[model samples]
Target: MAFVHSYQDDDDAPAAAATSLRRMELLLDPSLPQHLAGLALSQRGVLTTGQLLAAGLNRTRIHDIGRRDGWRTPLQGTRMVAVQTGPDASQDLMRAWNQAAALVLPHAALGFDSAAVEWGLVGVPRCDGVTVIVPPGKELRARPGLRVLVRPLTTHDVVSPWGLRTTSMVRTLADLLPTLDRPSGLAVLDGALRRRVRRSDLATARERARGSNGWRQVDDLWELANPDAETPLESRVRSRMIDGHLAPNALQQRLRDSSGRVYARPDMTIDRHRRRRPERGPLYIEADGRGPHGSPGAAYRDRDKASDLLADGADIERFTWDDTFDPMRIPWRLRRAL
Candidate 1:
């Protein structure tokens, strides 16, 4: 039998026209994978496989796509995330959330570091698996990429700020505290406070966390988190310096020229005593967090500030997240400088 190319008669259109029309239908259908072309992949990019399945493909199709080099598998099972191909890009963020959700099973909410990405508090690492908190009764064994947490959370503790049904901000922060380093933990907390996740919500989480490890630390974390800290690292670093007695008071601080107003705000500062003289000049310490100032531009500006301080005859000491982790390094450095 002759192949039927089109519904219309041959007089109506050419064979090429019918083929073109068929191709057009495939492009617009909601079922097909919506691969965004030319989109860049960074540490901040991610996608979920469930989204692919929902895009009119089954497990077999997904496996085929993987086999054909159409996808990259970063993690196994629950940790699996699908990165889209080409520049425009196609990622199923919702599907990623759901996959993380499946691993947590009942009584879980997308939260902490994971929520920080969801709420845009910070960049989500493309390689890391999603973070979720499951209530005490529903904890999963530690999988390769999955960080399954068994904790306490009430119904009210699982609300999201952006109208999504993830864990509430307070609960998120409380859950994250012990799991993350001080800087990363504080980043999520700082963001939550800025969004004004009500005190009552945090209080409720605290009540639920009464007997948990690291639960007591949340109050201290809350008290030290300042509004000025836009990023979690900022607040946590500041908090650690304070706890370590390394933080400098603004009034006693001097970073710029004694005559000029624009000065560097170093992460921490200390006064050095003189051996022969009555007193030595104060030391200005800068905490070069993840990016110095977080990017190249920020680093350049900070360098200028440092130059200004140096011009003013101030001694400067620089440290990073690692220095903070080591208690003796900071003090020893200052002592040697002094």
Candidate 2:
């Protein structure tokens, strides 16, 4: 933990530039073990082979350490130390992924969906390893557990945070489009909007997105992204509804019982003409994706709120991730309910 410090863009640090291989060899020879250990700690238990060599360690010593129990070679030239809770955990895996990216691609900036998570603009519902967008002249070979995209980014497209270069929020959302399905893409766009990212920013990113694969799909979500969608799952569910040719009456619709008691906001409302009557035409269609529903508190709240509304003569229905993905279920059930 001694070396657990934030990473920085190399251009910002003069002393770090001094840690070049030959310089490191000379500087760390006297304290090889401590220096290497510190580097490993700083990188969330990951250390690069270049670092070991710079630390004046021979290939034989590097091999021995990598072979020790709990160590793993996740990528060429990179070694990950033992995880306290093991590598199966999402938080641990994400930390290691980011740390490894910093070690293996020091000049690369984190981009796309990964950067969105880092900015707290979105949730980590899925992991596709660490994504790094490299500048020109830096060649990164394709490797497992790591994704590298090469492009010349404008200053506006990237930002250095916690010492690591990452895509700016707008650029991250645009870059993230290719990695996501239409539903998730919409959700992320909604998130960006909810976070107050200007629509013009997305337009600029969209201009940059041209000629890129999947640009069309991502761009298509621009019109559908409503800030009213509260969660990624909700956005995805709404996308499915649209695909099935069923549009909700309203987004994030509010409701009150006959007694004027308000309830939780549902993802959308159906049959708008009955807005004045809770027991009639318009009802709520909750997008309780399985991931969120699994949380006891979330589950309790969803059910409790809906049940209370139902008792007061309100109508409600729900769909899960499975239901949305199932080609027949969601559309049919929704049609029947409506």
Candidate 3:
């Protein structure tokens, strides 16, 4: 399948090809190395075959160097190249791939999970392919590690932050939430809210998406989103609890002493009044993701906090990323605790 540039018809192909040839010829000047370096830097070490050609390298030379050197062609059936620089190269691979996609398809805007990444929104799950949305009636065939879709988009729905065209954060959430399951969807919403996305903007996006597919899911998840969720894992756990009919009475509830001095704040709290038995006191749940809770100092503090809460006649439960994989695990354990 051939990738067509925006606004180019069969009649324009010959002119476009000639223009490309002339551009390549001009790029083969003595300053080619500098041009190639700048291009690679701008793209985070990713280069296209056209770029290599412009730098005076033939396809055979490009392929040989790529195979011999540490350079990687991340996207198959495409001319995209990623130069593996260091240990963190894999971390930036997706970003570079997204940049390459934007470069190749200038009229397309990064959408869905890829757009969420560009917007720096948390809780976006890893997707295997890059997604871009073109104007309705545009035809871009899907390639390996790349997803192209045609969707209606207004000028206000797109942005070019850091020079990469991407769907606005609100539009991205509206387009993305419905495609995910409840736990994942709520996590993304919680993450967007945590990033200070206004609820009014989200409401507006939801209303605009009213008649679209997955609109109901988006509407329902919006109501459940909580800004108090500090992390994606916490949001997922809370969502699971809600699904199991054990939504917490309060989130990030402050624990204070008899003197009214705040001592600890748990990730979530369930009042005994909300449980079947009121004699057992409140339940505190801590969602311990690896980053914040894995350190030796953090471990000591957690133990101390647990001791204090236990002494204060409160039941406590701590969960990690693994515990959230099983949808029923948290609810069952909390049920037993209650």
Candidate 4:
């Protein structure tokens, strides 16, 4: 049998054949130099000028290939690949958008909320542009399709992994530790530890982070995000309480009343401080980072538990995110309360 042939041109009687060929090429090779893959494999099909250049295609060849109807550069000197798809499509566009920015900036890495999404800390809706963290002195000119963010980072803060410079796994989690609630922060810490970023690495990063304005919080997070933590929320709370000097008692210390009713153990407990005035008594401490007491139901349970402690002639003091930030104020507040 002989093959059938059809001919069509820009304005031919049946000009759709040319368009059909282009569509077939897209179907076969989604990795086209200037083609934006599609809604299905959004992250897998992005190509950049550098990628094309690596494949032996020069700018002139790239231009010639796109001489006719081709991909548009949404930003001047920046190309965008628009594949044929529904306007309303839910795409896993984060990785692709980030890849584009990485390709353009080459020096910046995704950080903060951007890296949190990559490292599984938070869920983000589909975004159009890339969020990048660049070295302090590097400035990228404004471009139409790209939203450039120049997050200043010292050399110690940059980590090169998988051939890309990103915030180190520990540093990425540390960056979000202060902003994230307890459970979320615990989740991020768990993820990082599971990926084999060690506590020692976190310790080192924290040590280096000193003198940096926001880094004390990072150190606090290190203690809070313990890899061996079975009860992460409680652990975080305990660490914060100890940092605030509110937990004079050892972590996981056991306790019992005069009647021998054992308290399994409080995260932290301080024996009552007997003041000259009967009103000043020893107090118990609880750490209230985001996770251990994050949910409304959990908060209710905690309130009930605190009420029980009060009934037992124990005053209870709790610490939170603010306490972690300014730890010195905690002891003062506790003294006044006593």
Instruction: Give TM-scores for every candidate, taking all chains together and pairing residue i with residue i.
Output: 0.62, 0.74, 0.82, 0.44
Task: Please write out the lDDT profile of model 1 over residues 1-338, one tens digit for every residue.
Answer: 11111122122121012222210001112334446110111111223455555556678866764565434454453223234232212123433443445433435577666655454444122336656677787776766555666666677777643334567555555555655555555555556656666666655655655556666655455555445455544554555656555554432243444587646566545554431223445567666666446898987898887777666556877766667666566656655766
TM-score of 2: 0.74
CA lDDT, every prediction? 0.50, 0.67, 0.73, 0.52
lDDT of 4: 0.52
lDDT of model 1 at residue 15?
9
Candidate 4 per-residue lDDT over residues 228-256, each given as its tens digit: 43344444454444555554544555566
Clashes of each: 13, 2, 0, 5
Worst 10 residues of 3 by lDDT: 18-27
Off by over 4 Å in 2: 1-41, 50-62, 82-92, 121-128, 135-137, 257-260, 272-279, 295-301
Write the candidate numbers in order of decreasing TM-score.
3, 2, 1, 4
- Better by TM-score, candidate 4 or 3: 3
- Residue 95 shift from truth in candidate 3, angstroms: 1.4
Q: Alpha carbon lDDT of residue 195, candidate 1?
A: 62
lDDT of 3 by residue, 1-338 (tens): 11111221122121122122110111122333656654555565567777787778888877766665446555652344333344333434566678778777788999998887776566767877689999878878888788988999999999885677889877887788777777788888887787678899888767766777777755777878899998899998998898889999899988888899988999999997876667677899999988888899999999999988888778998888788789899999999888
Instruction: Give the TM-score comparing model 1 with the true structure, all chains together.
Output: 0.62
Task: Assess the local accuracy of residue 254 in candidate 4 as a C-alpha lDDT between 0 and 100.
Answer: 59
Which whole-number lDDT from 0 to 100 does residue 204 have in model 1?
62
